[model samples]
Target: MPFRPPPGRAAPDPRLDPYRERAGALFDQGEQIGVVYLRIDTFWRQTGGHLWWRRWSEPSEQVQGYIEFNGGGFDDFYQDAGTMVAEIGDWGHGRFPYRGEALQVRWLDDEESRQVRVSTFGLDDLQA
Candidate 1:
């Protein structure tokens, strides 16, 4: 068996659906770069949780491999954080909060209840 999902378990992960749009500021002071921190309102369905993602630009920001968001136990699948968006050129390959799953989101317009979900990150969100 090649890891086939059982019957009735055919429902795909929902993070692909940006139920809401989240608005946050980036570290654009010129003094810093890379992901300073991210803050998502909530995606309370699949795992019943919220997002308050944050990551500081360390000195070895570029040199480090996968910047683990190590502190303590956090959310499911995303308990550890890292520079997933760093040096990704334009866009990434898979759904963020729902990696390896068939989910995609163009934008997150509703943080309370994501009204629109997409399979790709908006061009603006994936700019250099």
Candidate 2:
């Protein structure tokens, strides 16, 4: 039989279901911010297994947010996060903006240990 998408969007692959579950858990662990959840869900649907993340409760940088690992050695998900942030227009830190925070992503198994910050760059930069 031919495949049909859901009411609003295309249907995601069944094989990628686990990734969605993990992504949901990670988002919840990271505090269940709505915009973040939507973006993360989009990322999961598009790339399948591009992310593996969990919440961390540390005093320093990894507080009240998620620590994501991209074993693929690329920042596609990070770029997606930035794009979503810009689209959502939730850049300012406050209640109006979704979560008022950006997610911290780390390239796992790579030589460098530095974390890449994803934030709203600006809508003007998007090509029309």
User: Which model scores highest in lDDT?
Assistant: 2
Per TM-score, the best of the predicted structures is: 1
Per-model C-alpha RMSD:
18.3, 17.5
Q: How many backbone clashes does candidate 2 have?
A: 0
Clashes of each: 16, 0
* Candidate 2 lDDT (Cα, 0 to 1): 0.25
Off by over 4 Å in 1: 1-81, 86-99, 110-128
In model 2, which runs have C-alpha deviations exceeding 4 angstroms? 1-7, 23-128
Model 2 residue 85 CA deviation (Å) reads 26
In Å, residue 22's CA in model 2 sits off its true spot by 1.1
- At residue 105, candidate 2 shows an lDDT of 20
Worst 10 residues of 2 by lDDT: 56-65
lDDT at 115, model 1 = 18
User: How big is the RMSD of model 1?
Assistant: 18.3
Compute each candidate's TM-score over C-alphas.
Answer: 0.20, 0.19
